[model samples]
Target chain A: MSPLQTTWHHIRRSPFQSLIATTAMFLSFFFISTFIIINSGLSTVLKYFETKPEITLFLKDGLDTATVENLQKDLSSYQGIKEITFISKEKALTIYKEQNKNNPLLTEMVTASILPASFEITVSEPEVLEKIYQNYSTKTNVIDEIIYQKDIITSLLNWTNATRQVGFAIILIIASISFLTMITIIGMKITNRKDEIKISRLLGASSFYVKKPFLLEGIIYGLFGSIFGFLFSFLLALIFQKSINSFFQPITFIDLNVNFYLILLFAEIITGTLLGFIASWIGAKRYIKF
Target chain B: MKIVFDQVDKKFGIVYALKDISFEIDQGEFVFLIGNSGAGKSTLLKLILNQLKPTSGKILLGDIDLSNGNKDDVNNTRRKIGVVFQDYQLISDKTIEENIALILDIVNYPKEKIQSRIDKVIKEVNLGTRRFLFPSQLAGGELQRASLARALAIEPEVILADEPTGNLDPENSWNLVKLLKDINKENNTTIIMTTHNNEIVESMGKRVIKINDGEIVKDYNISKKS
Candidate 1:
């Protein structure tokens, strides 16, 4: 019989054993793929917040043009400031009107004289916002009130880090469990086929030849497990895509296309195959003897 | 292929399984290794199979040193010989035909000729009709024949029957021995049969090497009938 036929025969003879092994592998890869999607979503949300304007400095009225230009240059020279956009009072009024365009009363009430000119500053890192706030908060002559969302950004970063750490720990535990499950199942198979192995060895079969079917069995379990796991994960992600997108409103955090999912599926297959190979190698090494 | 055991000694934790054993069987010779249980007959066969390394001496098969050869050498030596066990050792889940095919597959026999070879050996052992039956469905004698067919499928230079008839009835034992004798004469294959049945040994009138307590006590050949 061919190696594939032998592997299939072994699987057919003990279907319950094969099911248990494949199910264990499926659960592991499912969690792993889910974690990857969630982690990617979290990173997207973090990036959205990090790139937004964190600090907006309202300028004092009647400030000279040269002073404003010098202030712009000074802020530009700051180490971590990524961008500094000077919004005139007219531009601010225009922004307000555009934002409230649906309400005629609100649009009519806003004017250039009433709106404050501002400097919107974005930093490369969230921690840089604190330093800029501390250094520029004391400048009351050129700055009216400094507004920044330091607390919200800091909290978001902390939560993302915590979730990632916890998720990684869980994945590690699940991966280890999957590996052990494969080892135990394959080892049990070897034990059950002790007589067959002995007889084969006595018939002049090489060690590799005797173990070929078992190694192929392991690969089969891993390959099918990973494929099914990826399918389930993809289905779940599709089911929750709308909810996730609305939750992170305007960020499009979970806008994954079919190509991306296909890549993930490929990656999962490689991982599962590698895991199966190593586990089966260890199993065969521990049990198979001449 | 001839097998040579040169002053071989096998010790298991200071207890001698086989001690100072020296013997040589020429090519195509049929010899009976007669011994009781624990007389080191299995150990001697293991030495020939390269399953057990001699503690103090060398074993050579056709110039390949089994005692000190590499893994490939040992495997090559084993591939040149076939083994039959007392319990028939057929895989329970496979049919008799599959059991024979498995050996051919393991030896990397020509894929195109595998079916023909299986048919030839199965027919030789008179198991052609029962080729599709599993081991559990076959009677004791049939199982032994299936095992013998599996051994013959390899077309080995040597056939080692370790108590092949130990579980058979007297009539079945005689039949199996006759089959072995016919195979020996036809194929000129070396046959080493281990047995305690003195009646079969006396009636066969073939070469006999008797072992008692890990030592060779008797070596003789009876003249054949005209």
Candidate 2:
């Protein structure tokens, strides 16, 4: 019989041991896949926020349309400007009226002259926003106040960065636990088969011949456990689909996309296989030296 | 292949399993190692098998020195030798056919001829029609015969039987001895067996090496024909 067939027979002879090993792998893979998906989703949202304009440029009062156009033209030529959107006084008043529609008294007193016209500018890179303000905020007469969300943007980036670091650390820990668990389980199996191994070696079997089956057994455990974990997470996502979709804005709905599911499954299985194989290598090395 | 042991000593912590042992057996010779329990019979066999390194001596199989041999050299030496144990040592989960096939497989026998080899060896040991049976289904004699078949399947130059009949009836013991003798004569395979049974040792005596308390006391040819 092949090494694969023998490994399966060994597993079958001890059902409880096999179950515990499979479950250990299952939990680890499941947690890893979840972390990867959530991390991917949050990364998408943060990336969008980082590239969108957080700075609003209010135009000087009584500024002609030509001056506003020139200011818009000049901002586009800047090094980091990604987009420039112009809001005229009349249009600004319309937006103000729409925003205060629920408050009739507040809307009745608002006029075009009272509302300010502005140019909303976004940068290709968020960190260059300070440079943009220093270069043009006071240098241009057409510019009034160069308002920006330094506190909001910086804090958001920091939170996302911490989440990413913590998420990776947790995934790494799960993988380590999975690796250690595979070693312990395979070690127990080696002990159980100690006599068989001795006899095999005495019968002229090489060390590779004796250890191949255990290595294959570890890989099989990882493959099945990862697939199980992936499917389990899929079912969980399906059951909580509505709540997760509603948790963030519509832009983040892409987190639950079909493509992401498949990609996450592939990544998890590959990572699990590597972890299992290396763990088995370590276990086999320790015992098969005899 | 010839086996030579020169002043071999095997020690375990403060105890010596074998002390100042020296012996030689040529190809195709049948030698018996006779001693009481704990007389270092098994330890001597393990040294020949290269399972245990001697504390302060050298053993050579043909031109390959086993004392300081590399891992590959030890493995190659084992490939040229076959072993049968007292406990039968057959994997209980595997059928008789699988038990023998594994040895042939490890020896890198041609995959296409494995089944035929298994059939031939099983038949040689008089274990006909029992190849598909598990070890638990066989009697003590049958199990030992299966173990013998596994050893034979390797087609090794030397067959080391620690105690071929240690766990068998008188009838099975005689039958097994007869089988070993026939194979030795027909295939020119060296047979090194360790046993304490006086009747089995005296009946077909070829060369006898007696040990007591880890020392060789007698090395003589008591057989009348030799």
Scored by DockQ, the top model is 1
Q: Please give the lDDT score at residue A179 for candidate 1.
A: 88
DockQ of each: 0.70, 0.59
Interface RMSD for all numbered candidates: 0.9, 1.1
lDDT of 1 by residue, A24-45 (tens): 8898899988988988888888
The residue pairs in collision within model 2 are none
Q: Name the TM-score of candidate 2.
A: 0.83
> After superposing candidate 2, which stretches have Cα over 4 Å from the reference?
A57-84, A88-118, A123-148, A234-243, A255-264, B13-15, B224-226
Q: Give TM-scores of the second chain, every candidate.
A: 0.97, 0.97
Top candidate (TM-score): 1
User: Which residue ranges in model 1 land beyond 4 Å of their true spot?
Assistant: A58-82, A87-118, A123-146
